[model samples]
Target: MTQKQDGDPKSLSAEEAKAEFLALQERLRAADIAYHQEDAPVISDAEYDADKRRYAALVAAFPELEKDATQLNSVGAPAASGFGKVSHAVPMLSLGNAFEDEDVADFARSIRKYLGLSVQDPLAFTAEPKIDGLSLSLRYEDGVLVQAATRGDGSVGENVTENARTIADIPEQIAGAPRILEVRGEVYMSHDAFAALNQRQQERGGKVFANPRNAAAGSLRQLDAEITRSRPLQFFAYSWGELSEPLADAQIEAINRLRSLGFSTNPLTRLCSSLEEMIDHYRSIEAQRATLGYDIDGVVYKVNDLSLQGRLGFRSTTPRWAIAHKFPAELAWTRLEAIDIQVGRTGALSPVARLAPVTVGGVVVSNATLHNEDYIAGRDSKGAEIRGGKDIRVGDWVQIYRAGDVIPKVADVDLSKRPESAEPYSFPHVCPECQSPAIREEGDAVRRCSGGLICPAQAIEKLKHFVSRGAFDIEGLGNKQVEQFYADEWIREPGDIFTLRERFGSGLQQLKNREGWGEKSAANLFDAIDEKRTVPFAKFIFALGIRHVGEVAGKDLALHYGEWSALTSALDAARAAALAHRAADEAEDAERIAAEAEGRRARISETRAAAIKACGVPNEAQAAWDDLVGTDGVGPILALSLSDALANPEERAAIDRLADHLNIVPPDAPAAESPVSGKTVVFTGTLEQMTRAEAKARAEALGAKVSGSVSKKTDILVAGPGAGSKATKAAELGIKVLDEAGWLELIG
Candidate 1:
């Protein structure tokens, strides 16, 4: 076994550490399930300790790896079946990890940074022993225990109220508490109780639990409440989920309040004023780990102030307010078999590494991600060799480790055991699914297939994207139905989705007679499809599935254009400008070239001015290219891609056909009864009545165009306290100008 130096993750290369970290995460997660859910022993306690330590050292060494790595502080596996599921109001978030003393200091520093506090300022933290057991959430309504649940996947949990009522430590009712309260804590069995239960199991020739944590989890998950009552399960209130009213201002006070409410709160939790004190508390807890009646894996540190915690908020899956410093992991070795390329919805080819099955941590991992070709070639994105240029090849012995819930990766390859037939794998340069030419553009590590509309893979992917939750979101037209339609020739394009009832509703082979379709179901599907005919401008744009144009970009384009016709006209003008510019560049004669260039420039300038006038703003395309690219969040690359797609004759025809059948609504007009409604209004300087954003929103809501700058087409300019250049421009353009009060009166 290779022992990692304390606090030094740099001992291994970046690739090595990442692979080991991912493997350790998976291993630890499986170990957690076996120890906490299944009541089984896959590895010895010492081995589990070693795996956890190594995993922590790797994380501390390379902090950047933490972003993609599995969460280090998650307690148990997902809740087992046999109970109904309950959706939690506030998500049950997990904590981050702190392995060493420096890590603890960094945690404190991060909290200070998030809260904008200085080093000298006092920031208290509450330190508590991280209990090793199943997590339970008890809900109380009007001071009565109404519902109890186990944290399933953080968002939902299994309803275990009957099982929870059996635990003596749990309170059936609490006086002087909020009307709605959810107390979250750990449920565990003491060491002595576990020993006694295991002794009884052995005498009866039944399955004996390997540990108390496992015993408690197995006992509490029993389908029969009477069986759970027979077990010696205990509950310790340490935190909470949802509450109708505030418990207290600080963390320590809340725990004390839980204890006062007849809940068995952990007695060892302490408040520390400094990092030194917190570390001292951690050491004390570790020293008393064996003597503690219940099992504890590590110490947890949370920001003492509830307001500071609120400000800190959460990461994707964990709260930034707290961290659990864990112990080390177990390790194993496996052989690399082959590497495979899998194309995603956007046509980006991702590499997957196939490996010989090996158990590390506790689960069998047969595959890991090579990330990209660069990773397989033993180089970083910048072409720098990693791990001394140790490229992974087929038939090489590789070390693997698991931590929490992270996917396993190839840590280090054993060159000594490399097979004689091992060869360097070549990444594919073509789309394996469609036989299309895949290109890797500059500044991009990913290679994407360029056969848009023609490639079946790209077509199907786009169709799936169109019906996604954020896109068209049409009910009864899920991915499977879309796939079946596409395969059966019933639908080849998005436009076909709208024309389904027209083409096949009265035919002999009607949709009602299909395998999954009945008369009511077919009618429902048609009704659902028809109901989406008049979609919002943003939703329509997003449903197009143009590359790089996500939900945000779609809304941006919609707001910028205001109407579908305007957007199409702008794109057409842009296409014309591109052609003119190209023609000017290709002219060989100096005089002719100069003439063409001048004409092109004039055409572009004219188009821009026309766009500005129509839109009642100063945003004019220097060229058609500038108009699309200038929109917020729509960069040159995305703009070019959109224009190119629109420029294609076949694509344009299909879009036109789709547009013909649908009524694409323009941007909403402001409400009536206001004089400035439907007019282009510009706001300048500071508004005393409201913020600038509020003023603009109010104008737009009243069916007025809120422009940023004054132009000839601008109907009115609302000048405020500090009005300057814009006001003068409005006057020069002979546009009407109003003070803040005057504008408000006019609107009223």
Candidate 2:
């Protein structure tokens, strides 16, 4: 058997592993959302990959965590906020990964099965090098380039038409093209250009990028087209998005057509009609990878025939006909030198490890992101030290690894050779940069600075989140614009975004006269701002950018409270209940302390009603807390977060001011005619006709609330065969119980 690494997940009990798994999941979710939606990546790619592996290891130890959640569920954010956001006619998507030859074979077999063909049946394919650069889409209407966009979250992208025009490989106009054509491609910088540019930048005392891909992306997204023009960037088209008519019957033909229309296409793209041929092409591409002059991470294989690709269809996030076969990662050993904290655009204080330089997978690395203080300590979610209590520390030998990413990842700590002088690294209690108190809320993996607007790092991030696509989603106000406005002091907070027109509408500081702003663009931005004056309740709630309150939680809160007035009322009650709960805890603590001093016994246990009466907490407030906690998809943690946010005077006032800027529309009312509308449902035991998941979905679609447990509020209990205590409890409460058939009949 192969020996396992030092960070043995087996050290933890199943419960501890699960808890850590969930906490890691949440932390990654925030980082991913920032990357995909906010145009801000809090963690490096290496750290993201490492955490994903860790998440998978925990699930492997306990498969139940898979049902709990996926490590990173989706590539596209629900809404993407970036510069001049344009919705893609056809979404740019990620491809399923393939590392082993068996995975590739399985991919071919699955495609055949879906197409009702035998495994031996001839299925033509196209293999192309997967460019390690930013994805770009160039739109042409009537043979002229109209718009260019970068793949932001697949659903929407940032408009970069003027910047794209600076690239020599991108054609301004293509003769004899489709009436409406969208050419999808990669924008990259050659190794020579990257080296030369970095040298020139270093000489000029300007910013220098880490890699060619980073340089390419930075150059392309520049607000000033002159800067982009000065950068040597190239475009290579290998796919098409929206089209007025099909370019060709086959994928290869379409690629050739694009090449003929003056767009650069990958010369290495080849047609491989069989599985063996596809593998051969992959090998051929891998052999010449170093000499290619540009970086390519893997080879992508897709069905050659356009018709077959259409028939193969797409999953929610990826295409069934296409897969990216990646290269293997390399591993090496290194030493941990020091631990440092880096604050992200948000207030998240992420711990980073300074490592003794080591080469892994042909890349040299000095630092690796530790993710959070817990990761640095090798602690579980409950603060229990795992990994056999041998945490990562300075002067310890560590193992680092990487695939094709720029940064290397810390894989395992070598406590066997740890220095005797090494002590437990104490995570900072305050923000290192801002000197603000760093608060690690219960169940949160990372600690955050509580400085809010006073913290410069967080002030802009909050504004960015406020206007993010999932939030207010104001078009034309992306990262660069937000940063510029923040630096110029044109906008200081979320409310200032709404007052742009009022401040600069027709004055001497008219937006139209600004360096890059034309009359049309300025008016468009103001119009976009005005258009979002009335936002949906869920979006408005999400715009507040409260901690632990993501898009999903916002919707839950919106659905539960329905209206802002109702939500405020609930918050008030929940806050009162929280105060009462705190008082009761103090009383219990005082009783214990006094009893110890006097050497007398003190009564601690009390009935719920009795405690509420003793603490002078209103029964209505307690009931409100209970109701908020019981809301579908919401629990105590989320409820407490909402309550705490409203309790803070500064946050409350900011939220109120933002609310005043927009009309907060309540959630859509459920259908009043459905038999189970507005009723709470509980499902128990083995369902026959439908899975438990299906039943819950159907109930929800019909306006019925499906709860996990039965309570006094439960109106109906759908008990299947082998029903248990839930059914018994339902009967005791005089609640209506139904079989699977009865449930179906009632809904019908």
Candidate 3:
């Protein structure tokens, strides 16, 4: 048998696969929240898509992961709590991505296979410029606009009817239309409007958007309709969410009908009869990307025949009838001036490339992330050669690639242009800010500072994160303010924010008497701080800045544990078990390592047997570890990290100190009385009545846990047409199987 490659997902141990899957889930979920709910994307389109593809591959390599793959089915973050939730009659599904010409061809092939079309049979498709903007759905009844919503979580969205009515391109009334129609499209900002808005924001000392997409989203999602009206936003109607009558039997005609009915549509749309035509259109749109005066990340291809689209059906998160052909990342070459290291909140030392100022993807870049020391050494963590193993050096020419607002990255280094005096720069072995020894652990790619709380860089960054918008969100407390307070020794940690007023309110060094402060502004800051004295438990967890515990994990943990006492109880139980196991495992490890050091092969071999006996914990203690790991999103890796963070003397003290000053409230509970409440439900094959996303949202609303696969834990399986192995497995496991009709009746 041929062996798989070293880094292949298929070759990963069962434990490794589980750990990596959970991490990928966290990464994707965080990116989704940032992109959809926050209106700010943390990673580039390419990186997000790559992570998604990796998730898909891992699931393929190890099918057991599917049962825990709820993240794969998520469309976007849930609708913001600020607005009323509007459930879409027909879910607004996301389109799958196609990055290469082959992917496009495969998409066509899959469509043909689903339709049973012969190779000679002509297949028609509609190709349009995929606008880089926010998705919106406008509902009209009797030619009068009644409601509008953002495509939040694909199924339920935020009601933004008043804001949508203000866009000039979106007509409030149409002359002739069906009694009920839900026109769907994008809300975007033109390049000119984006620049002007940024300039205005700067002049007014307000937040500046990173890109036109962010600007448009921020403008449209404003609670005040007057604020949205004042912003120069535009709309383009390209699809429909729910319809009373069919506009046309084909995709192109439907778009035309939308345009005729007084809605702006993308003019670059074209009908393609073959896969070659689709690729050509994609290329053509990409060529015009820079000159279009607006952002278009890619081209979207859709099945031309509406009936064929209906037949193609939908996946959990995307429609099978459509795919987006994304463009490659924009790249430019620049001279590498220097390499610097920056310590993060986690004490990880990250290398940064200082480049001669050059524009990449319309953004001037003087710096790019070097990822870690291995990357600077021209090798990946696995020692695989990258960029032909040509190490990056100072004064060498490097190619920087940037995708939109994401940080620019050094893509390649040109050895031919290297200066005579250029050197392979030595990565620092200590923290640059504090001179603390940086230690690189086994299997870890980056060296991290060992100074812990004493490292000023780590302390400052953690403090900054504590007050960020997603965390405590203290008003008038930005990064600069946090740094200034830290440098002055007035505030050192998160808890210090709560003590500031008590410490300096009446003294000559009062915050009001400080530079950049006045009595009114100071009072407002204190009021903001006081208002945040009662923080939601999820925010508090995220504000702790624990490694591997992000906003998503915080929400997961909050949902799992419900209250502070229960969470702490679980942590304590797990910690005791973890300590017992660690001590035993370390003793066994020491014996085995010592045996190997003495070249005692037989003794080393015997340690494997001894390790098993040594590492075993009491059943009750083992159950504690299992209980924490069983939390839907937390795996062995994150569970251990969370346990260690709680076990650390200093970190635990800091957390408790911070908690003492705040009243932590639990998140709103899900519906608990529904039939599917607390039960695991799985959906397989194609549902005839509604899309997969809609079914999932409905099930979740009833407090059911919807999984992607059938297993012993699955309480119910909603099987539909073409149900295969999952259906068989559900039957084998005696899972309650329901057809589409039965599922609908039960839910009703």
Q: State TM-scores per candidate.
A: 0.57, 0.67, 0.78
Best model per TM-score: 3
Compared with the true structure, all predictions reach lDDT values of 0.73, 0.77, 0.81
C-alpha-based local distance difference test score of model 2: 0.77
Model 3, C-alpha of 303: deviation from truth (Å): 5.0
Candidate 2 residues lying further than 4 Å off, grouped into runs, are 1-18, 33-83, 102-124, 272-280, 330-335, 342-349, 355-366, 378-390, 395-399, 403-407, 412-421, 428-539, 551-650, 661-748
Tens-place lDDT digits, model 3, residues 1-748: 0011125787664444654566556557667867887776656676677668878877889876764565677787667645788999999889899889999999998877666678999889999998888999999999999999999878889999999989999999997888999999999999999899989999999988777888898888898999999999999889997888999999999999999999999999999998888888888888888899998888999999998787676775788899999888888999988888888788888777888998767656687767677778887555667777888898999987766666567778888899888877898887898998999854455588998899999999899878866678777888899998998998888998998878766542567778998888887777888999998998888888887776656878899899877887888877766765445444545664566578864353355455545666567667878777788766555666788888889988888888899999999987668889999999998987766766786787677988887778999999999999999998888889999999989888
Error of 2 at 347 (Å): 7.2
Q: Worst 10-residue stretch by lDDT in candidate 1?
A: 582-591
Q: Write the residue-wise lDDT of candidate 2 on 1-748 in tens digits.
A: 0011226777754435644675666666666675555434554454555566577677687754553343334464644333587889999987777767888999998888667778668889899998978889999999999999988768778898999999999989889999999999999988889889999999999997767777888888888999999999999998989999999999999999999999899999999978899899999999998899888888999999898787666764678889988766667899899988876545788777888887664455787766667667776555655555567888889887665544555667787798999998899999887899999754356688988778867878778777766677788887778988888898888888888898885642567777888888888899999999998998887778775566666777798789998988887977777766555545655665567689987665553335657767677888888788766556544566678778888878887887888898998876686899999999999887755655776687677878889999999999989999999999999999999999999999
Model 1: per-residue Cα lDDT over 394-482, one tens digit each: 88888765442234555567889998888887888899888888887533456778777777777887787677545666778887998
Using alpha carbons, what is the TM-score of model 1? 0.57
Count of clashing residue pairs in every prediction: 23, 0, 0
| Stretches of candidate 3 exceeding 4 Å from the true structure | 1-44, 51-95, 106-125, 134-167, 172-184, 187-233, 239-254, 271-277, 287-291, 303-321, 505-509, 579-613, 672-674, 681-703, 706-748
Could you give the candidate ranking by lDDT, starting with the highest? 3, 2, 1
